[model samples]
Target: MFTSTERIKPDAQTIALYLENVLSHKYQIPTFQRDVVWEKENVKKLWDSIYKFYPLGSILVWKTNTKLESHREIGGIKLADNFHSHEYQYILDGQQRTTFLLTSIYGNKIANKKNFNPTLYIDLTIELTNVTDDISYAKRFLFWDEIDDRDGQIQANTGKKKPLQR
Candidate 1:
């Protein structure tokens, strides 16, 4: 039953490159995949892991000649619907991670949430040089709604007023 199977070498790509593929319609989520439903805290934790150089589990993608209906948008980034390619990579797992990463990097509006901006912002004032493994990342990373705008300066949920430096 597995006669036609072939093992493909695992390829590593930078986060930027992977997202670029997603933007260019090279990577897509199958229509059957569940929508992104990660809460704000989960996203912050994911970023924390990245900031600490912790390994994020591999994102599994299935490349095939078959083209199934895919999502036109992921994490507010619109994909090229008219793209024509001989092969396509459908995300088999890590949909939540992909969506949050895309949304955090490219600030955009998330669907089904009116006036809710999912763009993640980092509190530069936080001293990350001495972060312990048990520390919560909530203070380091925040969503738009989690920020308090006062006097044109963005403050984190902690209410500490730190000057935004560039």
Candidate 2:
């Protein structure tokens, strides 16, 4: 008995992971597509939603074998092909998610200067001690955004100092 297509689970990380891949110059988007540009409010809304575990929305992906040309360098890195054409998917309706994921997580400089890296709020951590307020975190995206929880107790804990606990 089919569940009437209601059994499909919503994947919150789908867009995020896709954006990461794209930003890392893994999957290339169509060159004719316009550059991603969203304001800080939209970005904060997304981050807040994500932090609250709210369902952002479903992203449409068109898995295709049709290869497309890549846009210019994203944050100084030229996206190159790393997989077979059959696995490629054209983003049908998730440009916003793509934008967030590329600029923030990947720390990719925007091709459009008007929107700089406004969406990025990442900080880096090094050697489990250094938080990157004075450093960059492009190679260690996972280590970024870490809060020095101080043993899982948030009470009376001043998280501002302590080097942000990288």
Candidate 3:
């Protein structure tokens, strides 16, 4: 007993496409949606999941002809306004995930955080071995600050060569 409007279908989108839409303002967050609140550790975990090819869950979007007030920015990244389109897709959930993806890739200027660099780095030198409960990915995935600290030690040891990739 499903009508056309009631039927739901799943669509797969690449990270590139998602980010493009975010930059273009095709995807919008409703005004009622909560602000970005995820800390650095939380962001690291999310990127870790992606690096392992794990499912990052779905972002629910509601398409409607009715336009509603939406957030123009997330984590200091400004989204363009789409006035030509009569239809809009408002994100009903997945605000945190969306924000993380946007901020990590686009960088952010979070309040009270000085010189926050949301850039994520992965150590290609790290070997992939058999998983154990004691094993951690902390060394493999790092933030800018962590890499900076390690870079200082590495620079002092044998000249300078960054190990992490952007």
Best lDDT among the predictions, by candidate number: 1
Model 3: per-residue lDDT, tens digit, 95-140?
A: 7888778777777765435566766667766655755422346666
Q: Report RMSD (Å) for each prediction in the order shown.
A: 4.2, 11.0, 4.6
Q: What is the lDDT of residue 12 in candidate 2?
A: 51
Q: In candidate 1, what residue range of length 10 has the lowest lDDT sum?
A: 156-165
lDDT of 1 by residue, 45-66 (tens): 9998888899988999998889
Better of 1 and 2 by lDDT: 1
Query: Candidate 2 — which pairs collide?
Result: none
- TM-score of every model versus the real structure: 0.80, 0.53, 0.77
Candidate 2 lDDT tens digits, 46-135: 654554467878776555577766554544346665545556755556666666655666565566654354434432332222332322
Pick out the ten consecutive residues of candidate 3 with the lowest summed lDDT: 151-160
Q: In candidate 2, which residue ranges exceed 4 Å CA deviation?
A: 1-16, 23-26, 72-77, 81-84, 122-166
Residue 146 displacement (Å), model 1: 2.4
